[model samples]
Target: MMADDIISSFPDEILCHILSFLPTKHVVATSVLSKRWKFLWRSLPFFDFHYDGDLFDYDRNNEAYSHFLHSVDSFLLSRDRDEPLHRFRLRSDSTYGHPVSIQRWITPAVSGSVRHLDLCLDWGFVMPSVVFSCKTLVVLKLTFIRVENTFSVDLPLLKILHLNNISSPEGLDLSQLLSGCPNLEDLEVKGFISTTKGKFITLPKLVRASILEDLLPLEVVKDVEVLFLDSKYQQILDFDFQNLVRLELILQLSKDWLGVLEVLEHCPKLQTLLICIYKSSFDTFLAGHEEVVWSYPQSVPACISSHLKTCSLKYYSGSIDEIQFASYIMGNAKYLRIMKICIDSESHFTFGEKLHMERELSSCMKSSDTCTLSFEYSS
Candidate 1:
């Protein structure tokens, strides 16, 4: 009959849904509202717990830290066993020397069959083994953690997995981790450094992947249909992608042009291609290498002759290698519908040189009669 009573009189399921949108701390605090709202948060499917303070200060704030730990324990203890958890997120900058406490907090989420699990901890805490075998998990994200190679993973329904700044021991077998997820589609691994020798990582059903690492392994790129690669390593020409449809590459300008061309020759089904060129401080180091001679391919790749439709070159500087590559694609891409080039602002070429370069590209013998070319200067 009144505004206050309207929300309080909501059905139990609706009240839990509303509380699921709030942070775990705020949801717990709502117990003080009234007797009817006392246990409503216990059935909420989502829980997010974040502690932003320094863990080293636990001695000075022992009472506060103890209270926070007790609150987490109480919250998990109060959850309804019959209700399934949809998402669980816990982030702590410092573990405060109590890895066991963190483990205890996560055990219930795993047992409850949480669909999405996100855990971020600064200290190198060994994750519980139950996480590796979470069959109900659809998404899993871990940050600043270490994964051992001995554990077994059995995530049958997992579709998305993100591992950031993750480290592994000397004998860690990453292939074991990938093989467990049969239906995984999207995977992102950034700042991952393997201490041991390389392992062959395979994902047969993978549709998209982003790998940003110091050493980009060829095995990880083999089966992906769409890939985004940003790496310091330049030895990726040896790998082949037969089913690849789209590719986005971010690389330093000092990369070997011959190697890049070798990679392009391997993709047979590439329909869309984007290359982002960046200026690196190691230009002098790159200059020491032998120059790449402009030798046109005897026969154009199958992708260029039949499949390629959209091609973009960003930060184009009209260098010899850039011009040759662009000209080759323009001349050979029979199905090309759009070819867009963005000139670099800090390019070495003059205004007249740029105009000449554009005219040269426009006059190239295009195999695709309906192909259109567009040029613009980088802002």
Candidate 2:
């Protein structure tokens, strides 16, 4: 007899590749397509499981929640033990669930030599330690999770790592985690951190790093080439960033412009600079003194005079302080090639006001004769 379906004739590897694009639940549902497909999902190299609990309350719909848990558990248990997982992602938006279930679900994938792992949940829970020492893990992202430095982390091949709102116990230093990621090249960290003083690790391969708030010590990230800082911790910028090339800063409207100039003074080799100013609730209380008065520095920063090539100002309000700050950079940056001014929609500048603002900044005596200035508004 002829084959019932030509698709079933495809090798298991090919069929699994086609099914990998579908959701984990959908992949399991495909078993009814044919007897040959019954065990096909077991050999899949990746799994993506997502549960959006915002649709219903878990307390009132225990049956649905239980069914979700059971379904996930059964699918994982039935997966081929010898098959290596290329990637695994589990995201739960539920405000409540069994934390132990997370550990149980991840253990098998870690043991299966998963290369990439991503876990995002609405609540915090301690992560399984087995994930820390996974030899095959290359990328790891954790959000709303607690990581304990209770065990040694030896991710020799890990290149990218993101830790968002990761809570750890007091004196649990981050150096313990960085020391193990010897080959890590890119890292992003958010939230606050608590650690004992004098504990710092240097990653010779790290070239890119993004930090939000007071998440880590400056000493650990000083050698990065491309750095992004989004916090009010101006003290962190007090250090010399000798290797920094591209820098981005998110500052509040109430912050001192002098502080930003002070930062530029330290990055001697910086070539690109982006500054974004955001309004804060504290601006209301400091209304009279909210605007920063820009003063021309006695000596130009080394970066502005030599290495700086591009500068951008975002959320530009048509305030005198903003105009002065833009003009100061335009006047001093000898090698600046591009200067972008992005207006804030909330400013509601009239056509004439915008033209006037443009004219004022365009007339500045720029040291770089080839510099191009452009203005933009939110679309």
Candidate 3:
């Protein structure tokens, strides 16, 4: 069959499914394709409109956006509650005169049947309260967006929440938000660096969390594998996670060694542990200083995980304190099968540092003859 024939022969449901992935502008434009496609856009439950101003023509941007939402609202308003939104995404760089205009345009369709809502507006104003606590929403991604005050959202069915650069200055208690979302599964919290006071997002049911906030994320996500973000030292609350298996701790700065060691003491069954220590913040200092003042842990915690088998440490420096920490871990990791250390090549450590590091290697070999330690150095 010819291409046109195949396209024309497709079912209405199939056509709607295909149109769901396109932008609202393109979906609305399909009305002029043929009489059959005139009403095909309305049946499309999925609406994805990600507009980047650089690519699209600037002159007609506002007009194009206005028509798109009007069409979506008119279509949804014509439908019933039994027909809820399957997915709705609004990611744009379009600078509307007022931020509420964007909310005013899209609020109706969101009420219809949106299962997923992903909103990211950089230069826009605050979003309406209805967007935060949508009932039918199962997955929500909010970035550079602030929720309105004087309202409490109850997202009883929200399963996944990914928030970045979000803040509530007007006493927007985060514990209340998490209290409502009992079924939350995956949480990714990233905070604004310029924030003066600490911000917290509490979740009781988060199974997996990716934390990039300055403040320690203390939650009761028990029996789940935890992956920590890059930090020099962080003091976090302890949870009873006896069944924990995997852990990824990224240490880039040398702020508080004592706190981090304390955290390691609790993970009893952390089989696979990846430690990434970055040098971006200390590059200039490393060159000027003769001996690096590593924030040595005053005392190593008594907690040791006999089940830890695999470990990876990045940004490994051949320093006395570094070796000491390594020695302690290597000696204690009785069941360790493989250990990998990532070293920088440009680093010309002083003679004393090299000797200290060698002592750690010898001690490790003597203690655990069966353990395997491999060093990956980059020159």
Best candidate, lDDT-wise?
2
Highest TM-score model number: 2
Candidate 1: Cα lDDT at 313: 89
Candidate ordering by TM-score (highest first): 2, 1, 3
**Per-prediction TM-score, please?**
0.70, 0.82, 0.68
Error of 3 at 264 (Å): 1.4
lDDT of 3 by residue, 247-280 (tens): 6677655633455566666766677777766656
- How well does candidate 2 match the true structure in TM-score terms? 0.82
* Model 1 residue pairs with clashes: none
lDDT of 3: 0.65
Better of 1 and 3 by TM-score: 1
Clashes of 1: 0
Off by over 4 Å in 2: 1-41, 55-67, 169-171, 234-240, 285-290, 344-359, 377-379
* Model 1 lDDT tens row, 223-304: 7888887735555466679878998887675545555656778888899988887766665466556545578767777888
Q: How would you encode candidate 2's per-residue C-alpha lDDT over 1-379 as one tens digit per residue?
A: 3564877898887888888788899999988888898888888889788887745555655666677788888887888868778889988877677778888878878876788999997545677778888889999998887766546778999999988877776434667777778899999988746474435677788899998767567767888999998747646465788899999998776556777888888899999999887876666566667566666778888998898899988987657787887888888888999999988766767999899988989998888988999998753
Instruction: Please say which candidate is ahead in TM-score: 2 or 3.
Output: 2
Residue ranges of candidate 1 with Cα displaced over 4 Å: 1-40, 50-81, 92-98, 195-202, 212-221, 230-240, 284-295, 314-320, 338-379
